[model samples]
Target: MFTTTAGKPLRYNHWRKSYFDSAVSAAGLADVTPHDLRAPHGTWVADRYGVMTAAHRLGTRTRA
Candidate 1:
């Protein structure tokens, strides 16, 4: 249900740091970016659980 201000459906790669920077400023978060959040999420899940668990959370199947 995500859409841009232009009323177009939001796609993952469409937004860049400039877009996120504006959003973060509007939201008044001290400092955070998309890459900052995504990396640790992957690392934490994989480190604590395993690759298979991470893949499952991301809706991918473990292959033989």
Candidate 2:
């Protein structure tokens, strides 16, 4: 689970872009956003199983 510096569980809140940009740059991932982390897992699962099954396992509802 994510937490703040004050030792409280991180609930809903927006983080600054500079914060994410610095982390990404430090990790040496160029042009990567926080949201990009999910794409590889999603694609791997979907390709291995199926789109519908992967969506269900991911707890996401998809029409197709």
Candidate 3:
């Protein structure tokens, strides 16, 4: 959840280009996108909690 200095939600494109990219570049990470972080987060959640919890956290539906 990122917000602007004005306390408004940051637009995805603007945040990606202006903030995310610059931070990633400064950290020396190459070819990474915001969506790329989701997998590792999901994996960590699933491992620590469970698949259902991870799915819930990720807003994904589980099959019955």
Candidate 4:
């Protein structure tokens, strides 16, 4: 759900190259992809909310 400076939707390849890659490199991280942030983001949400909330945020289905 990222957008370009002009407010157009950002394509994945462009975002990966122009934003994600640059940010990771600037942060001194290597070999990290956007998908790699999921686990930590889920944990952060779950800690403050709950597993179900995290699941919803992550678009994951959970058996009840």
Which candidate number maximizes TM-score?
Answer: 4
Minimum summed lDDT over a 10-residue window in model 2 is located at: 9-18
lDDT of 1 by residue, 1-64 (tens): 7898999988766775548777878888857868677667877898999987877776677787
lDDT of 3 by residue, 18-62 (tens): 989999999999999999999999999999999999999999988
Residue pairs that clash (backbone atoms under 3 angstroms), model 4: none
RMSD of 4: 1.8
| Candidate 4, position 38, lDDT | 97
Structural similarity to truth (TM-score) of each candidate? 0.38, 0.45, 0.76, 0.82
lDDT of 4 at 12: 93
Q: What's the number of clashes in each of the models?
A: 0, 0, 0, 0
If the candidates were sorted by their TM-score against the true structure, best first, what order would they fall in?
4, 3, 2, 1
lDDT tens digits by residue: candidate 2, 1-64 = 7777887776543343637777888888798866686778878999999888778877798674
Per-residue error for 27 in candidate 3, Å, reads 1.8
Give the runs in model 4 whose Cα sits over 4 Å from its true position. 6-8
Better of 1 and 2 by lDDT: 1
TM-score of 4: 0.82
Q: Is candidate 3 or candidate 4 better by lDDT?
A: 4
lDDT of 4 by residue, 1-64 (tens): 7788899999999989998999999999999999999999999999999989999999998888
lDDT agreement of model 4 with the native: 0.95
lDDT to native, each model: 0.77, 0.75, 0.94, 0.95
Best by lDDT: 4
